[model samples]
Target: MSEPVTLRVLGTSVTLLESIRQRAEEELGIRLVYEIHNVQQAQRIAVMQPERYDLYDQWFHNVDFVWPAGAIQPIDIRRIALWDEINDLPKRGRLHTSDKLGAGSLPSERLFVQHDGKLGSQPTERISMLPLTHNADSFAYRPERLPDTLAATEESWSWLINEGWCGHIALQSDAAIGALDAALALQAAGLARFENLGNLRLDEIDQLADLLIKKQHHGHFAAFWSDDQEAGRLMLDPAVSIQSLWSPTLMQLHRAGIQYRLAVPKEGYRAWFGGLSLSRRAEGRVKDAAYAYLNWWLSGWPGAVMARQGFYISNPPRARDYLSAAEWDYWYDGKPAREELPGSDGLPLIDSGERREGGSYAQRMGHISVWNSVMDEHNYLVRRWNDFLRARKAA
Candidate 1:
């Protein structure tokens, strides 16, 4: 018998690794070695020592910058026959265009084939990296607690962050710093920005930092969260009442019996995506095995499991087949997937299809208006954001 292909994965959660392991070993005829690491630790290992893992589970939103730094290689997707099966979204598809992608990033609706044998502008190149699942960000709040005036206008992103609701706001942790940019984009559209104070820009951060320093402020944040689990917890508990959150996590919380409402907000929620990538150091059969694993993930049973778990799949078509009509209704609306799925607070989640879309949420904070797409500015913004946080921490 051929030797089993041992695939080591870093920065994946135990649940996710277990799922992958079951699929890879049972289905792929390959041996799997999986390791779980937090995002920070994974980045540190990748930077400090390159060969720690063969495959790294990284978020796609930030993965593009790593390629230029030699941390990872563009995936050779052409080797995987199912490459054509995967769905490529706007920002994600543009990651390999030799052009930096950010807010206003264009979509590659058509498939480009490989060239003579490289991963670049040529259409026929191998795929650089494959993403697994992603979370969509949007505004969420407790419907019961919100004032009738605002709750009545829930269709818009503006109502949740309106001045009347600002004082009760909370933001996500710094890891979810992108939520800050989303807030800025909303403010640019003449909507009210949540005053988390933690996610402010370099100049704007000072005032926020000062307020936080004085108030010793702590509230549920409107920012994106670093820990996937916390999103559910925060939604269940009224820490800040209103903030940006991932769709799946919130849905999971609702299913677990929490009572909360999520909307795109008037300005729309900032969208971020996470996926899988290959370490540049991986070679030989391991790389080939990794490709196999990626392909397997895109097709077959695992993709279904992931979609049902509340995440958006990069392989949309395959994922759709996995979810039932009821699941679609639950995802599309706040309703329970079925009688078995309960809201986070132990009640049934709101099922009004009209309710989710009726508010000013889409008008004020929609995705198109909210993302800061200037790719060139990402470094500057990230650096300033980090520095501002540093100063805040020191103060």
Candidate 2:
């Protein structure tokens, strides 16, 4: 028997990993091992040490950090079975719009490889990463606790920093994601404005950091979470009334019979795209196994499992085959679930007739206010973020 192919993937991918593990082994004859890490650790590992992992399944934001480090090799599109069926987000250059960052700053701008060993937007046989799961994120609040006065007003990201929610709010612990969340909240609250929210300037970083520190000093945050379990735990805390949230955690909370409303803020949702990449070290039979894994990821089964957890697959048409009509209508069409919907664990999480908070897939993705990103001043941003974390009151 051959050695198992080891994959370093994000912790959020647990369900997908479990869902596909047995089948992938049966179909490809390659045993798979997954090393799960938080977003920060996953980014660091993928960029600093390729030898430890054969494949990386993570957010595209990490491309800024990993690609230049030469830790990951470009994927050959010809190898991907559904390459043409992939979403137009990359080919149409929609990722580099003016409202978004410039070409150099856009992660998808250099998705294709050039002859100079550099990435470019031009069509090429090689791609930086095989785009996979994506989704829009927003904060959630306990509607019953929401003050009537504020409920009448427009829901906003500024609520994170609102004095009224002091000691009752939570935030993501990741610097990259937390910074974007804070930047949006700061702009909405009129505390500061960013020229390019994805890539913050030094002054913008400082301003946002200072505000976060001040909020911490006042005990504004009830908790800071790094994973779905942590997010779910924080949400269940009576002290927490609102916080940054992801779709999977929302489903988890619902399963536990906790009622929370995912906010459709006036400012819009924080969107993100991510996928699988082969490590620079992968070659020979291991490389073949890696490609097999990537193809299997887009082969419909994994995509359908991800859909149950609120993620959109890159090859939607392929994924459709594995999903039931009720699942498709509830998850993609934004229609109410006609029957009880099972979670990744096959246990019912959503009851019939419950509408998704942001509505349909198109409606949610179309309203993206910002994408998850690694700023040019990432070093300085990390320093400031660490400072805020150090100054925060212990929960």
Candidate 3:
């Protein structure tokens, strides 16, 4: 038997592994081994240690960090089975707008490879990554904690830093996302305004960091969660009434019978997209296995499974083939569930008559306020982020 092909993937993607492992082995005649890491750690390994993994599944935001290190090579779109049908999001760019397709970032922003080995928004046979799953994110709040006097007020990202919720809130600990969320909250609260939400200037980062430190000193945060499991635990805590939330964590909370509302913040959602990439070192049979895995992911089964948990597959039309009409209406049309729905884990999550917070995939993604990204001053941002964390610990 051949040695198993190794894949380094984000921790949240364990469900994909569980669902596809056996099928991949059966179809490709190769065993698969997975190594999971948090977003930050995954980037470090992909860029600093490409030889360790044959395939990498990660967010597009990290391409800037990893591509420069030559950890991953461009993917040949011709090799992708459904390349042409992969959605206009990755073709024209997420921010692209036309009479036919609505406004959003051009998918080519990170998809196409440039002559200098960097990524660009130009069409090329070579692509930095194969766009996979994406979604908009917002904070969740306990409805029971709502003060009756403010019952009719619209939920806003401002709630994250609202003095009333001080010491009863949590934030993501990942620097790239955490910083962006904090910046959004600060701007919403009129604390500071950033010129670029995705890439903060040093001064802007310092201002946000200082505000976070001050909030920590005032006992504003219940905790900082690094992953979905921790986020779910924090939501279950009585002290935590509101916090940044991911779709998977929200589903997990619902499965546990916890009642919460995923807020559609007036400012809009923090959107993100992730994809699959081939390692620079992957060659021979291992390289073939890597391609096999990527093809399987886009084959619709895994996409259908991811869709159950609030993620949108890059190729929606393909995934639609595997989903029921009721599932499509509930997940994609923003309609109430026709019946109880099972989550990625096969546990019941949404009850009948429940509606998704954001309307449709197009509506949510089109209005993306900012995409998750690493800023131009990433080193400085990391230092300030660490300082904020230390301040919180001291407090």
Q: Candidate 2 lDDT, tens digit per residue, 276-357?
A: 8788999987888888888888889888888988889887878889889999998889999999988766778779989888
Selected candidate, larger TM-score, 1 vs 3 = 3
Query: Which regions of candidate 3 deviate over 4 angstroms?
Result: 1-16, 95-107, 148-150, 393-395
Clashes of each: 51, 0, 11
lDDT string for model 1 (177-281, tens) is 443543453454454344432234444443333443332223212333555566666666655566656554655665676667666544444554455678888
Give a tens-digit lDDT track for model 3, residues 1-395.
Answer: 65665544432443445656666777766777767766667777888888877777777777777777788888987888988778776666553373233222334577799787778877888998889888889899999987564478787888899887878989999888887888889999899988877778888889999999988887888888887778999999999999998888877788678889999988888877778888888887777777877888898877888898888988887888988888888888888999988877677777899988879777777667777877789899989998888775352
Model 3 TM: 0.93
- Cα RMSD, each candidate: 6.5, 2.7, 2.6
Estimate TM-scores for all models. Answer: 0.71, 0.93, 0.93
Model 2 pairs whose backbones collide: none
RMSD of 1: 6.5
The order of the candidates by lDDT, greatest first, is 2, 3, 1
Every candidate's lDDT = 0.52, 0.80, 0.79
* Worst ten in a row by lDDT for model 3: 98-107
Candidate 1 achieves a global lDDT of: 0.52
Of candidate 1, the 10-residue stretch with the lowest lDDT total is 104-113
